[model samples]
Target: MPINSYDYYPLSWYPDSTRIKRPKYEAIITLLEEDIVSGVLKANTKLPSQRELADYLDINFTTVTRAYKLGVEKGLLYTNIGSGTFVSSNAFKSITISTDNSPAASIDLGLVSSFEQCNALLVPAIQKVAGQQTITQFLNYQAPTGTAFQKEIAIRWLSTLGVQTIPERLSIVSGVQNGLAIVLSALFSYGDRIVVDFYTYSNFIELAKLFHLTLIPISADLEGMSAIELEKICQLQEVKGIFLMPSCNNPTGSILSASRKKELISIIKAYQLIVIEDDIHAFLTAPFLADYSPPIYQSLPEQTVYLYGMTKFICSGLRVAYLVFPERFKNTLNRSMFNINVKTSSLDSEIITEVLHSGLAQQLLETKKALSQEANALFNTIFDCQEVTGHHPWPYFRCLPIPKHYSREYIETYFNQLGVNVYHSDRFVVKSDYEKAFIRVALSSSSSLEVLETGLLKIKEGLVGLE
Candidate 1:
């Protein structure tokens, strides 16, 4: 039975309104979950309305709404039309705090990180930096963007990716995410419209939400974001920017072709849209193969903000990333970087500096390519996945069409029970009604051939079971 809205006055139960070390919305969700489980708020109890809670707590109404949405997702709350939100009957039963004895992860094929082999080179590089006579500089403060010497090394690193840019246009960031946040902050404002692929990087989607920017998802083909679709979208809306992974897109591993790049560049010029070319995986795109086409940065340097970083190819422990800002936006980007975090670690900069100059970076890349070749062979044999889109050096992930027998929900449950974690196709989609039938298999997440083979075999068995 639904509780009458007037039956329950706004319970005075609230968390410590003073100490807010975490996000306010998350804090609210935690408090609500705690109260529900402790029986302080019985099941079917009508809670305070979002507006009333916001007014009482003196917090944003949207924050309360977000908390309620998250609570619903976690099965802690339910809502009724023309009524009010109430605690779910099973909320206490569903909410169980995880412990160490929880089922161990069978395999994680979701996140794509640096190859394990990079750790070998990273240790020695750090040791070399520790032994340097100029170690005092690592302890001292540097510019928020980066020092001139760090930028010089970064320029050389960018050249490896075929990006030729001066240091004045470059800003050193802690990682690619930080660089992206700074760039987005500098270029766009709240409520601004930006364009992205229908299936794009999840992190970029989260970043868009953080900035309160609207992401218009455009349908794409195998070659990547469709320029024709983008043109139509630009005609329809006043898009401020376009965020894309041209060389090696995340999850899907799709690359934008040269002709399409030219076509998109034409549209970009016509619309004067700010372009963010996330070339993080460019270096991972076949270490041995020659360049087939120039990057968009080369053709449209003035409009594109090229993001290059070491975290993908090198170990993530060295959180080093460099952004080539358009010369006109230097002041804006520098100011944004300062307000975010003063600067990246000087020690990390020095370590990457040593690796780039000493040729270890190239050696590490070659090792990664070799490992990728071996892993791809295993994946190919298991799934016979010819439709895989990523190129050599493996692009860190492969997006394959989901077998017809299994719903994505079924696959998620099957694998999750086996302690395997996989990213569903819908997770990467920008639109809620997206119907793409695909799942991303992170090729690089498994630490070894044994683990990769085991995970793939398990997926194969699950597919067969569905049949």
Candidate 2:
């Protein structure tokens, strides 16, 4: 066969020439697996010619040929004698399931670095405290409620959001989800009514369903859930409470406007309803917007519970989230915590406190802001998405409508093929007639500009292809 005519050249053809160290055969196989899993190596895509792959990887031609055979044996690739090697249709599905059983690889994109990077500084400071005689207190079982110092940090963090609260009034939970679960358990009996925006966090919907709570979808304008509609629903239904993401709402990324917040607060207060505010994405916004408080906090009666997760901004592994309750609900929340898990993790609390004290918290925040800015710029360029009115990149969840005929899933699949991960709008919709054929790109995770640009270009190519 003529070398020029051969089409089964392996992906090794695109190797970086300056990389003098040859990748192990296993590493090469893993690379191919990732390409397949991410959708880069699409189903039925043909491998390059063995000679071409060898030249690309700067390895012996036999090595390329052997690697191709190995991939086939592993069921990642298939070959016909004359037709050439093609990616197996089920390659990624198998890999996805196997990944669950295997030890995690080093480059898991789902992993976020803000908290991990913060803990690198925190661990030493904590060790210094551990060296003290009183450190033994940390190992022993103690109060179901957090210590005064932990509460202080929680208060300080909340203060940044313009919420004022005392230690006695707060209950430190295992994490935001735990806190959410407890609130759901406490507030709603099975089949109670709850209202949320049409495109709110899916977790809220899942939780409501799990708890047997009836969820009502509230209509939303560009400013977020409409106050008039929310009031009308509350008057009509026996709503126990409402779950909301008033700031940088998940999936849709709509920031509830100040006026909308005020209207919601007044309506909820007049109806004497419970409000569960999920402010997980609050800190990701620009610093200038830090002081913006949810109207629910200011306008609602004392029964409202405001929840904030340090995990999203810090690290998911930390698993620490604090909730500020109305003064009357402190006893009730504390009892719920004791009944559920007895207490939050003191070790996690200490580590988080160290991060806050070491100034790394602020540094990470700054780093995140910068990263978000760069990612947003890259996203805008790649999609050529005219910023929809009221879209802000750093703190807001930005949605780009998928071009006609292109489903959000197709865009997701296309990006996955290019080694990029992203979410579609359907991930956030609860109950509504709204069409969700849009991409919801999150900029919270730290990524290199080069990687961002490469991913964006691939997305742009996919979008252009749709046109």
Q: Score candidate 1 by TM-score against the native.
A: 0.77
Relative to the true structure, how large is the alpha-carbon lDDT of every model? Answer: 0.74, 0.65
Residue 368's lDDT in candidate 2: 63
Stretches of candidate 2 above 4 Å error? 1-133, 290-295, 386-389, 403-414
Q: Against the true structure, whose TM-score is highest?
A: 1
lDDT of 1 by residue, 298-346 (tens): 8788888988878878776688888886789889988998888777788
TM-score to native of every candidate shown:
0.77, 0.70
RMSD after CA superposition, every candidate: 7.7, 17.7
> Number of clashes in model 1?
0
Provide the lDDT at 443 for model 2: 45
